[model samples]
Target: MSGVLEKIGQTQDKWFVFLDKLESRMHEICTAAVPEIREVFEQDRDPYKRAHGHLLMGLRGQINQMRSKANEVREEKIFQFIDGITSELPGHGFFTGSHDRLYTFRIACINRHNLFEEKIAFYMSLLNNAAGEQDLEAAYQEQLQAFEAIRDQFSCKQCAGQMTIPDLFFIATYVTCPFCQTQNTFIPSTGAQMVLHQARSLAEQRTAHLLKTYEESKPKNSLLYRQYLRSMFDEWNKIVPDMAEENEKFYQRLLQDHLNSINHY
Candidate 1:
């Protein structure tokens, strides 16, 4: 009986030591990840943050690998030991007090593991919030006002006839001169072009509340996500109605992706 107790004590000590090492490793990874995530997000060359997403995905993969390792260790080393001890408890006459102690230890380990998982989740949420905090609506409005200020300043290149740009064009477009019947390429300034690039972001900003509700729901209701997507695309089309067909295709593709992610069959 004393020998069994000694072995159990040793196993418990090893479990705690393993958890301590894991905690230290988790801390190191999380501490290193925060600055890298922020730097990637802030310094991304792509206005749409595509480069940031790609780099951050790699970092998320590393974090997932660390989590997988911890889960594997808990299952293989901790749970297996507890299960083995539990199976032997019924056969041992001297395991009454020891059994209670082992059960208490198991509960403590489970709670500790859960706490670690919560910390990881909280860190991930902080990073996500930071990424989504950009005020894209303000940028869109700034670009729109800049375009409006310069809309009437264009003149035909072929005939030097004063021409009014009737609509907002993101790229160079052929404008017909009424005086000479000549074609002139109207080129937008850099700021005007940025409006097209940020159109979707502005729409997202407009419909972010719906997305927030979807995100806050437990089990992540896909129906709520679909509603948010529809609303967001509606806002997108309102911004750039010419791209509605293309946006609809993109929306369908995203729905298919969501289906693939959640449905096994």
Candidate 2:
């Protein structure tokens, strides 16, 4: 599992770096095309050519919007991935064997990942429509698929072969092998217990490394950092379900007190 987290952390870091480069390239393409688009308008006095500039302008606008959304989605997804991998350690004995800071982090991470996945799907739809070249479109689609696959792979903690409680009950818990019933107490330790512990340790180490890298690599713009923090809080705010019923009771009590005060007066 730790190996999985480390892999996910590395992949997520790469994804963000790739997005940054891709966005820069996309911006350059748009900038380069702008003058050619303008020249098309200037050279051809035809009404069709004049209208072509408007079409180009619209395409440029759409592409820019998609690019912006893609970056936002990428950042959110990266944060979520980091959150998920680090969070698991505390719950599964990462910390003091009790769910604590690590468990909270894990839940936060899962929520963020889920939210980013939804947002990315929307961005991808926009990309599909805005992309001009067939090659570019194909490349973008491949990246999107890769991102989804990676996300899916990171969501689970254990391998398919890992024994579940039910499986354990049937195999090791209940009936001993007839030939080896006397040897039942000679149960050898499954490597899974050791591997799981090792995986958590590896995940924690990788997460700390990634966090340090991200902090060091981040732009020094305070305003941008503030904006990023705000966005993270907004994303976090969306995670919990509403306690409408609880709020309604409070409102009812307040209303009742106000009415009683009026009646006594």
Per-model TM-score versus the true fold: 0.67, 0.28
lDDT, candidate 1, 102-204, per-residue tens:
8777887888778778866765665455465667777677877887888778788888888888777878888888889798888888767877787888898
Assess the local accuracy of residue 167 in candidate 2 as a C-alpha lDDT between 0 and 100. Answer: 20
Candidate 1 lands at a TM-score of 0.67
After superposing candidate 1, which stretches have Cα over 4 Å from the reference?
24-40, 43-45, 83-102, 171-173, 185-194, 210-234, 241-265
Q: List CA RMSD, all candidates.
A: 5.3, 30.9
- Minimum summed lDDT over a 10-residue window in model 2 is located at 162-171
Error of 2 at 77 (Å): 4.0
For model 2, residues 1-265, the per-residue Cα lDDT tens digits are: 5565456656655665655555556656655665565555556554234454465666557666655765576557655655665665545534542234335444554555455445445444443344232222233334334434432221112222222121211012332333323322222134322222233233333344444544675553344433443343333222211323443465457556645655675
- Clash number for model 1? 0
lDDT, model 2: 0.44
